[model samples]
Target chain A: MFDFDATMPLMAVQFLLLTAILNAVFYKPLTKALDERDAYIRNNQATAKESLAKAESLVKEYEAQIAAARKESQSIVEKAQAEAREITAQKTAEAQKQVQTQKEQAAQEIQQQKETALATLEQQVDSLSRQILEKILGPELVK
Target chain B: MEILGSLTILNTFTLAELEVGEHFLWKIGNYTVHGQVFIVSWIVIGVLLIASLAATRNIQTVPGEIQNFMEYALEFIRDLTKNQLGEKEYRPWVPFVGTLFLFIFVSNWGGALIPWKLIQLPSGELAAPTNDINTTVALALLTSLAYFYAGFKKKGLGYFKKYIEPTPILLPIAILEDFTKPLSLSFRLFGNILADELVVAVLVLLVPLFVPLPVMALGLFTSAIQALVFATLAGAYIHEALEGHGEE
Candidate 1:
């Protein structure tokens, strides 16, 4: 049953030929396709992860910008309210000053008129007393 | 009457010989070749080639049925190569290992399924190519060459240092292991396949009924296992050959 002939070399050549052919047709192309698929999947996953990260960062940046804008708006509203309050206080102070000045001026004018009337009455009283004294002396001399 | 008639038929040298070694030898310019082995092998190779060409023709990322099977087979062989031959240099060995696996697997199953006896030759009949000692030996020899080549290529002159390792006392044994490796590899496949076929054949001859079905099923199972074993061992041998020895 153990026979060695040219069959060994022949079979070897046949196997070698088959191996080469199979590598060309089967193993080579099949593995290439499989590997390409694997690489494609890996690349896709990487791209998805990158895009997700990019989106998250963009969202964070947008939120930060919104917060900054909101703060700026709040600051602007506070400045406007403070300016309105200062203007109202200044106007009230000016009005109070004008009322005080008018009261003083009116008091001064009334005092001046009262002073003039008193002076005129004193002068008339002196004149009347002198006339009465002259009449009494004249009557004593005739007796 | 049936027993006598069976005996007469058996003696008349007709219908599945008990001694199944006879070959329909072909002489080509003073060279002889086994025709049955050639025919069956040609058929197996043709099937593999056609399937491979068709499935690989378009080369899509998403697989069809044939592509799926082919890809799975390639993935399996790749894993086998990477695991056994280690990660660094297993890529090149995948084709050889895959070829061996596919050929042997196809042959064993083909032998079991095909009614090769129907294709009557002048003397012998068609069967699995792996059933021949020549084919198995050829496969074993290829595996042997692969390991040795891997060793020489990786380590250069340092490949001989392994035979004397753990002290020179084990030199003979290590060398003997090399010879026995191929011997066992070839014989194991040849014997198992031959035995399975013979058992199924004998069962079919005796009972000629449902009894042979289980044996045939077992044959198919073992055929697959044998192919796996052969490929795995070949890969492992190459791995061992390629292993690094840090210094002298």
Candidate 2:
């Protein structure tokens, strides 16, 4: 029917009431649930991203330290080898100089001993010839 | 003689002559209300309330069957508001638009589904609340008020300034459209629902068996379409009122 009367206002009021009630029970809760799930997903993704970045940085730092340590150890071993070689060469040179001085002293001692022995033998021979001449001339000169 | 014989057929043809303008009037405080509209509408509202409460009581991230369907339906309604009213301004008006769609949708399908013939009325038989012109008029008037409220609230008194813009010549025509908006909204719903009911009734009277099934199915489709049309138009009107220009 085309009648308006009280029905119009009443229907309006009823619809408004229905809207209010439905908003409370239906729209609000559903939106909340959906938004909650969305936020949870976004939060989890952020956490995962942060953790991955941290782990990557840690791995990089560890690799750099290992590289530095390997270089340091290699330099230490090379330095020790250089020191040992220098010491060995210096000791060999000192031992060769001492041997040369000892050989020269031994040669001088042998030359001096040979000269003393030759002089003693020559004095003995001269003394024996003079005694034999005196014994042969002694009797006639006295008569 | 032939008239009398045809009158017998007319009598037997309908369950009750389509009570086009009839209402079981209730007198309340110097005002008469349509009782049948309220009766069926209350039932529709009660069903909506119960189903809504049941589905949403134990709200979970993991949805159940009824809850899933209800969410899909509500999401569809939200999308309608968003597309019509634009994105930022749509959230506030969801309740208003959702109520119109659900109320009309439920009422129309209720009229089509409920066996109101079994429970007879004293004056006229029971039907959908939308079958009454008064109810549609009330809903259309609310829509007009809503758009006007949205415009006034959003744009302040500048809302009325659009009437004379581009020229003052179209002011009267623009004002005339305000009246026609409600008229068209009410009549479209009332006419379609009433026609569908009459057609289905006639078919059932003629064949009363398998013949009415397809028409009934079509009636369901029309019911849903009408509900969507009403809600979408309501949102569009509000959208227009809130916009800066009417030159388009």
Candidate 3:
């Protein structure tokens, strides 16, 4: 007969029970915690990668905007300068025409004074009036 | 013979030789525990512990020969655990499962190597711990317990629900399957180790020296296989626990 002790079977059962209890108390949580930690690490890694890509793309978008703004401002300044030059040229021509008209009026008055000094004031005045009148008309103005 | 005389002297000093079965006697308050093969087994376990500890105590990164061997064994078990249970949930159980494998492995091989004949007790010869039904059954029961607890804790009452799955037609069978899992796992290991050890003992007896070498080699193989089988079942059980006993 095999040397079977009564307690031996109990010991085997106890072994089963003991290990089961140990697993319940220790192994299960240990593994659970480990798995949880692993998942957390993976999730964080994915989030990090996504955010990193987002940041990189945002930087690229900002850079493009900055470049576009620079070009737009450059064109705007160039247009404003061209407009300023045109206005300056137009004002200069207007001022020169006004000076020419003033010179012509002064010259006509000086010619009338010279005729009065030469003792033909009345005739000169008459001629001047006629000239002025004719100058108001188209043929005298052309002459 | 000379071995018996030496054992007597060693037994006088070390508690490792305290026998509890058939030979020596100790009366403690009218209860006597007999000394038989248990002492030799305890001594075997102790020696195993000491040798393993020594091998790993100052483990170098580069590893000396013994350290390398121990590391290889540990890493081998680690990989097995990783592969079977997966990298996700196999970390903590590595030590427990790996220790079980190493303990059984060393015990099995120890029986083959250390001339068991060289050690003597008053009655029967000492066999490997695995050869004893108690040890194998104990290991099997523990593994079963581990998986059961893991399953319960992981999936809770839903784990039991898994047993009543497949449209309830296979409920009874599933329950039976759950019960048989531990029995099969335990018996498989016990049967293999016991048979291998018995065969080797018989062969050694039949032929004193030469013919037993091959059987000894076979014993080594059996030891490794049993260890792997035990670990594999443990990993499978853990996997089942993680997945739960769902319909699939």
Candidate 4:
């Protein structure tokens, strides 16, 4: 068992040959595949992160646009309400002025009719009084 | 004496006998090799190759089961190498360290799990490649050579300056460490694996029942730890060489 012989050198040669064969068939290609897989995963992760950032930014932009549109629409509604209020006030004032002018014209016509009737009644009363006096006294004696 | 004599007689009746320090030798052009080690080692290597091919056949960005397992293993080895050698120098040495870990881990586990005794051998039965001293020594020597090569390549002749660092009187000790490194590495693996196998074999011979189950499990655990220890030490040695004496 302790004997040292030519087997040692030949076994060494065989081991070297095995090493060479393993290097060619095993180590080189396997390492290459591992590296390629690593790179592939890393690449996918990077792109995924990039797209996520883009989506977040787009969400923020759309939200801002929506907020601005809401403010603009609110202001437009308020402006329309204010304009309607102003037009209603103007129309109401114009209608009140026309009603006041019609009332003044009707009062003037009633006053004119009353004055003409008073004047005619006074004339009729004078004629009746004169006739009554003539009938009561004798006409030849008084003359 | 009577009990001992009777125990010897009882041992022969067991299903399998304890085998130690035996080998199936095959003659090459001018050298003899352990045929059993080679046979199991080829099986281990074939398993590794098939698993690797299946994992890598349909490579995709989104990995399936086999691909995921292979990637996990690769990542583990990368982290181990990086921790030892630092970021700058770990890339080149990942394959070497990973190969050592995988080979030793598989060999040790295969030795424990496979029923090599069932297959009758002419001489010695098959075992883990690492159970043999030759194989561990070869692995340790390779680690030594790798570190030395790394040091030389990175620092050139300046690598030798580490022996005299702090004081020249420590030169002999530093040089002695080089010899001890490989010696300890090889012996640690060989002894642990061989001892585990022996314990299991002895238990199986004695009881031949469910009694050896826990020890077999323990053997498997130790086998994995031994593989880890060997790989970690080898990586540390390489890192030490690459770091040089400049920092110290």
Best by lDDT: 4
In model 2, the runs with Cα more than 4 Å from the true position are A52-143, B1-17, B246-248
TM-score of candidate 2 versus the correct structure, residues matched by position: 0.74
Question: Against the true structure, candidate 2 has what lDDT?
Answer: 0.86
Q: List, residue by residue over B1-248, the lDDT tens digit for candidate 2.
A: 24433543756544433555667788898999889889999999999998788879988888888788788878898999999998889999998999899999999999998878778677666898998887899899999999999999988998988787768898999899899999999999999998898888767656767888899899999999999999999999999898847544
In terms of docking quality, model 3 is incorrect
Q: All models, DockQ values?
A: 0.51, 0.52, 0.04, 0.71
Instruction: Please give the ranking of all candidate structures by DockQ, highest first, separated by commas.
Output: 4, 2, 1, 3
State the lDDT of candidate 4 residue by residue for A1-143, as single tens digits. Answer: 78767778988998999999989889989988888888999999999999999999999999999999999999999999999999999999999999999898889988988999889988988876666666677555434
True contacts kept of each: 0.74, 0.84, 0.06, 0.74
True-vs-predicted CA distance for residue B115, candidate 4, Å: 0.8
For candidate 3, write residues A90-124 as lDDT tens digits.
Answer: 99999999999999989988988886777787778
- Displacement of residue B67 (Cα, Å) in model 4 is 1.6
Query: Candidate 1 lDDT, tens digit per residue, A1-143?
Result: 46656676788888889999989988888888888888999999999999999999999999999999999999999999999999999999999889888888888887888788778778877776666666767646634
lDDT of the structure predicted as candidate 1? 0.85
| lDDT of model 1 at position B132 | 90
Question: Candidate 4: TM-score?
Answer: 0.89
TM-score of chain B of 1: 0.92
Native contact fraction of candidate 1?
0.74
Question: What range of 10 consecutive residues in model 2 chain B has the weakest lDDT sum?
Answer: B1-10
Q: Give the per-residue lDDT digits (tens) of candidate 3, residues B175-220.
A: 7876787777767776776677656644544444678678778778
